[model samples]
Target: MVSLVPSLTEAVAETLPGTLVGATDWCSHPADLDVTRVGGTKNPAVDRILALAPDLVIANEEENRAPDLDALRAGGVEVLVTVVRDVPQAFRELARVLTACGARSRPRWLDEAEETWSAPAPARPRTTVVVPIWRRPWMVLGGDTFAGDVLDRLGFENLYGTHPERYPRVPLQDLVDASPGLVVLPDEPYRFTAADGPEAFPGLSCALVSGRHLTWYGPSLAEAPRVLAEALRAVRR
Candidate 1:
């Protein structure tokens, strides 16, 4: 199997080791993963992937480009494209993908991840938050996003959750004008840090979170709630 999505690569690698023969360069989890690199999520080397001749190629709608996937399909490779807009969809898709990979039973980690999100959230008022995934021209999590749903389940409301675009670019001044109660910054797609991102919002509280925990949907989902909640709490301290 080959995986174009990083999270899916981790999922398949953990569920059934030695199952993957090829994966994108961005597949970083399981740190010691040894597989043929097929370039990247957006621009996978189709020739390299075809040469690997994987039985299945796992990809996410958001992380991969359609043309690349089409090229793979045209090469007679079976492509399993997944759409995960929210947390529930993530679990459902993961299960489906694993089942397609020939798992006789659901993986234990997947079950644990489901249980983690199913538990009652600690009693805390929902704080309005703006999540920035990028800078230069600021971009934020808008509506129908897995990360936004994760935060919503954790007792936080995304300020731009009603926006039409999933990830929208807004001017810095406009983001500041929104006046969110807190700014949640994940360290991926842009690598926002304490010194870099927080200074943009002088008075607002900012939480520097793990991009993997905040955005990934594989084994990390099992620990994301605890990791993310601690990061949120740290800003309060």
Candidate 2:
């Protein structure tokens, strides 16, 4: 089996060790894995992957681009594409992947996370937050992205989640119009550092945050709600 993402690699390895063939180096997954780091500008160990002759290649539909998928298919590789944005979608995708690969997956922590975080609660003011993936243009999760839902659980009103599309392009003026209480810049798809937060987007209540837990959409989300909640608590007051 071939895995495309870091969380998936970790999950597959944990679920079925020695089954996963190899993983990409620059996919920006949580560290600690048996992987070969191909340059960010280069292809993942494609030669080695081909040699492995993986019966099935598992990849996220949104995570892997069309060109890459086309190439894989053209090469006579069997690829399973899974796209998951919400909790349900995530579960569905996970189940499908595990079953196809005969890899076992029990979402034990998903239930624990839901019972712990998704339980009903008293109402509070939804904190307005803006998540920036890039600074020059200030792209944010506009609507229906996994990051948008992560903020929703924190009683956060995603100022941009209501936009026309997922991962919409946010002009600086539009962000200003949104009037966010907290401005969060991520470390992946774009690297937003604590120091960069000030120089790039000044006059905003900003912080640099790990994008994995927020953006990753596997069992890893079991950790996201708690992790994000901790970060929000520190910054909200």
lDDT of 1 by residue, 35-106 (tens): 999998989999999999889999999999999999999999999999998898999999999999989999
Please, what are the lDDT tens digits per residue for candidate 2 over residues 1-237?
Answer: 878766566556655657776676654444555554432223454556667778877777677666676676777778888877765676567667777878555556545545565554327977788888876667788888867776786678788788887777778877766668887767777876756654544565665566887777655667776676666565421
What is the Å distance of residue 97 in model 2 from its true position? 1.5
Candidate 2 deviant stretches above 4 angstroms: 27-30, 36-48, 105-117, 199-201
| Alpha-carbon RMSD, each predicted model | 1.2, 2.9
Q: Return the clash pairs for model 1, or none.
A: none
Query: In angstroms, how far off is 4's CA in candidate 1?
Result: 0.5
- Global CA lDDT computed for model 1: 0.92
What C-alpha lDDT values do all the predictions have?
Answer: 0.92, 0.68
Taking all chains together, each candidate's TM-score versus the true structure is 0.97, 0.85
